[model samples]
Target: MSLPSYQKAAVIEGTELVIKKNAFIPSFEKNEVLVKVIAASVNPTDWKHIDYGSGKTQGSVSGCDYAGIIVSMGEEVEAKGDLNLGDHVYGVVHGSSLERRNNGAFAEFVAASPLVLIKAAKPLKTIAKGQENIPSGPVETFEGASTLGVALTTIAITFSYYFKFDFSKKPLEDDFLLIWGGSSSVGQIALQFAKIYGIKVIVVASAKNHHHLKSLGADHLVDYHDADAVEQIKALGKNHIKFGFDTISLPQTNQKVHSAVSENATTNSLLPFNPKDLEDYRSDVDITVTLAYLAWGKNTKVPFPWMETDENGAAVSNPGFPEACKTFFKVASKALNEGSVKHIPITVLPKGLNSLNEAFDLLRHDKISSGKLTVRIEDSA
Candidate 1:
C-alpha cells in the first residue's frame, strides 16, 4: 500500500475546521501508529472546544472517534499483543487538543497511540472470574466500532472509580441505575453496561425513543419532557436505585436527579458542574464528575502507576495511563462483542468533510436527538 505525502484534512480555523486539500499528516512517537481513517464521528467535546476556540494550535483537524486500517506501527508496538500492520482498528482520539492539534480523525490519515486503537470486527475473548477466557461476541461494523470509544471510555471510568465495581464478577441482580438523558449516545452505551452487569435501568428521554431504549435493555423509561418526569423515575426506582448518571448535567437536571435517587445514593455526571451547588438541594447524596480524557492528559496519574508522555508526544516517565486506557478498551471491546452493545443510530451528513459546518449547526441547535451524527470519510469495505 502506498501512502500519500500529504493528505486532505479538515483544518480548524478559529471556530470551524476548513477542509484543506493538502495537509501534512501529523508525526507519531515511539508508541504510536499511522492509520488510514475510514470513518469518524463528531462528538460534543470536539465541538465544545471549537465553540470556545480553545484546545488547539492553528491548523489542527477537528474530530474524534475514528475507525481505520493501520498502515504502519511504532517501534514499541511490535511487542504489543493483537495489533499488527494492516489491521483494521477503531477507537477515540483527542483532536484539536494542544498536543494533537495538527492531527485528528477528520482526515484521510491520522497518527494515534496504539493505546487508543481496538481490533475492529473481532470476537473479544473476555476474562471472567479467575481470568478464564470466554467468547463474548463479535463487533459487526466500523461505524458501530467507531461509536464505542468516547462514550464507553467515559462511562467505564465512571463505573471503575465512582461506582467501584469489580469487572471480574457477575453483576448484582438487585442493583438498579437511573440514566438521565438516556437516548443520548453516552446514555445508550451506559445502559448496555448496566444491563450486562445485571442492573435494572431507568431511563429518561423523549417518549418517541422509548422502544429503542427498551431494546437496549432499559427496564423503565420516563419522558424528560413530562412535567412529572422526576416523579415518574422516583416511582419506578423507589428504594432500589443505587446509582444515578446524568448525561445532561444541567442545574435543573441535577436537581431532578437528586429528587429521584435514594438518600446517600452516588451520582456521576459527565459535566464538570460542582456538587457544592447541589448540597443545598440534596446534601446526603454523593456526587462526582468523570472526564474520559484524564488518562490521556499530561503528568496525570489515577488509573495507572506511572507517567507517560503528555498529549504533545514529549517523553514523560508515565507508564500506567496508556496501560490503564488499554485495559478499559479491552473491557469495552468485550461488552461490544457480547452483542448487547450498539451504537446510537447515525445521521450521515452529505458532502463528506464539507458537511461538517452544517452538521455542527444541527448539533449546536439540538436538531439531533436519539442518535449520533457522523461523516463517512471512506465507504465501507
Candidate 2:
C-alpha cells in the first residue's frame, strides 16, 4: 500500500485538539511495524493530560491503546520475517505521547515497537506457574489484546510486589482482596487478577455497577452510594481483607477505602499511633494498602500512614508509585490471551481519523464511565 502525505488527523491547536483536514501519517522505525489502526482506547491519561495539561502537550493527534493491522514493516521487522501485512495487532501507549516523544500515532499510520507491542503476539503457555508467556499463534483481536496493556499490568504489579505474593506457588485460595472503584478500567483489571491468583475479591462500586463487577469475578460488591458501606463490609466478613487497592483519590472519592478497610483490614493488619489513654499496644496482623500513582511531591496526601508497614517489607512512603507495574503489564497481556482476563468493556467508535478530536472531547469531560472509550483511526481491512 502506498503512503499518503496528508491525512485526516486530530490536531492540538492549543489545549484542544481540533480535527484538521491536512495532517501527517506516522512512519515505522527500522525496529518497528506500521499499523493501520482500527480501534483505539482512552485511559484517564488521555484527558488528564489534554484538559489538565498535567501531561505534556501533543504535537499531533492523541489517543492510545490501539488494535489494528500490520500494513507495513521496517527492515528489522522484514528480516525477522514473521509478522506480515493484514495481521491483527493490539497494544497500549498514548498515541499522544508517541507523537511528542518523536513518533506520533494519532493518525492514519502508527509505527510501533513490534517486539514489545502488547497483544501483537499470541499467548503460547502459562509459564513460571505465576506468569504467562506470549509465543507464536493466531493473535487475539485488538479489543481483547488492547484490554491489558496498562490496566492489567497495574494489577499484576500490585500483586507481585505491593501485596508480596509468592509466584513460586499458586496464590492461596483463602486470600482476600478489596478493590475500590471496581467499575473503572483499572479496578476491573484488579478484579480479574484477583481471580487469577485464586484471591477472593471485594469490590466497591455503585448498585448499578454491582452486576457488572460480579461478571468481572468480584466475590463481594460494596455499594459506595449506600450510607452503611462500612457496616455492610463488616457484615460480609469480620476481618479478612488480605489486600486493598484503590483506583480513586480519597476525600473526593470519599473514604470508601478507609471505611471498607477499617472493616476488613488487610490480613488482620494493625496500625500504630500513640497509645490511646496510655493503654494501647501493637500487634502483628500483617496488612498493607497500595494506591497506584505516586506522591511525587507533598501535594499528594496519603490516607493510611499509621499502618505499620512498608511496600513489600521495604521502607517506602508512597503507595501508588509507577515504574513498579511494567512486569505486571506483561503478566496482564498473557492473562488476556490465556482468557484469564478481559479488557474493561469499550464503546467502539466508527473507524476514521476524522472523528479523533470529537472522541477525545468525550473522554476529556469525564462524560464516559463504566468502560473504556475508543476510536478506530484507520480501516484494518
Which candidate ranks first by lDDT, i.e. highest? 1
Which regions in candidate 2 have their CA more than 4 angstroms from the true location?
Answer: 1-7, 20-22, 25-32, 54-58, 71-86, 98-105, 114-116, 120-148, 164-168, 234-237, 262-330, 356-358, 364-366, 379-381
lDDT of each: 0.71, 0.56
Give a tens-digit lDDT track for model 2, residues 14-85. 676666556666655787788766656666655555665433454546655667678788898889876777
Best by TM-score: 1
The estimated TM-scores of all candidates read 0.85, 0.68
By TM-score, how accurate is candidate 2?
Answer: 0.68
Q: Write the per-residue lDDT of candidate 1 for residues 263-319, one digit (tens) a residue.
A: 788898876565666645677788876666665634422222212345644434234
Q: Which stretches of candidate 1 lie over 4 Å from their true place?
A: 54-58, 122-139, 297-324, 379-381
